[model samples]
Target: MDRFDQLRILTAIVEGGSLSEAARKLNITPSAVSKQLSQLEDRLGVRLFNRTTRKLSLTDEGGVFYERARAILADLAEAEESLASQSGQPRGRLVVDAPVAFGRYCVAPVLGEFLRANPEVHLDLRLNDRLIDPIEEGVDLVIRIGQMKDSALIGRRLSKSRRLVVASPDYLKKKGRPKTPEDLKAHACLLHSLRRPQSEWQFMKEGGGVESLSLAGAFESVDIEVIRVLAIDGLGLAQLPVWLVARDLESGALEEVLSGHLSPDPDIFTLYPSARHLSPKVRSFVDFLVERFGGERAWWATKL
Candidate 1:
């Protein structure tokens, strides 16, 4: 057995928390993963994991080994990056995770240009609304909107997006415009299920305080795009990221409401694992996104 390869497999299992998950990430069969673990344990004469029906936990010995193994792997990665940078070309498979709507409307549109610029780089883009753990998933980078929860990862602020309460002109005409946040209770509000307190909306007060209101809706959806469409069809009021509705606002399909009293702007961020040496591929990709988005005055803002 190659000890180095077995060490990598062992760390993958620990990070993934199950044989099946590790196998999926490594692109190997679960049986193969199990066999490698068994061999490694036999050679070391020490059990690495305490396995239960639902999950796997590290043994005391495993914890010690895992820390050292991770350090060794990080060092190896840094050495590899140093050599790759010397060549001055970004290559290899780069895995990126991004939110669904933003990836579809913004990031995905610019990918072809990135591909053309770096012919040797292979891109693996995964678009999902769920928050992903980059280190656990072996993702090279992730484009995230809103406040970041993971401090262990390094984040580059790409842009800022305002969260605005909006409604179609036809809807406002039919339902009548709400002059205050309290009036939303009487209006048909479209709720985004992914947001916390889905029925409650938050805003900044003119006197410099935060205001929150519980709202009722005729329509609700986990998908932001669906809510935007529902609002456009004159169904209800919807609060959405400016980037998503910038074009709609420009086309006069949607109009901002309570413009000066909406929540604080949420930032767009590109996150990656904190590493000793950043890979050229990750570096190049992040720089390209920053330049494309134009930092504070993003392309989305330009549309508005």
Candidate 2:
């Protein structure tokens, strides 16, 4: 039994959630995967997994072993990557995750150039709005916008996007424009359910102080795009990222409100699991994004 090979198989099974799925990922039959797991357990003299009809879960000892195994595998990969990096070309599969709209509009457009530049690398991009655990999901990188609450992950700020209170010209005409952040209380606001405190809006006061308002909205949705559409249709005012609503603002489909008192811009970050030796693929990709987005004058700033 190759101990390293068994470790790889064990991690694969844990990550893939089942023996069959691990087999598919490893390009082997389920029986072969099962045989390896059984052999590994026999050698160790301990049960590694608790199997049910629907799923397989790690035993207590297996859980402890898996963590150590993962670290060993990561160290081995890093050693191999260090050798590969000497050739000055990134290779292997890179799994990345980003929000849907940003991934579609900003990230996707630049991927062609990235792929063209690095012919040896293959990218697997997953677009999701939900926050994902990069380590658990086997993701190499995640592009996230807004405040990051998780301190466990390492991050690099790629760009910044301000939240703008905006509404359609028609909506503001009928509802009347708010002259101050305080006046927003009387107007119908469109809220993003995913945003923290859903109804509270934050802004910077003229006196270098921060103020927050607990607002009420006639419309709300888990999707920011939904609120954007509703706001565009004269439904209510919506505060959205400037990057997400830049085109609309430029086209006069939406007009900025209380721009003077808008909240501090949220940063765009590429997050990865905290590690001492960063993989070349992740490092190169992050550098590419920072340059593509513009280190200081990000593309989104042009719209503003």
Highest TM-score scorer: 2
* Model 1 agreement with the true structure over 1-304: per-residue lDDT tens digits: 4877788898899888889998998899999999999998898899999998886999999999899988888778657667888897897778999999999988888899999999978899999999877888879999988896758889888877778899999999988988888888999999999988799888887888888898877888999999989989989999898888989988999999877576867788889989625778988999999888846665875534
Worst 10 residues of 1 by lDDT: 294-303
Q: What TM-scores do the predictions have?
A: 0.72, 0.73
lDDT of 2 at 161: 72
Q: What are the clashing pairs of model 2?
A: none
lDDT of 2 at 158: 78
Question: What is the clash count for each candidate, in the order shown?
Answer: 0, 0
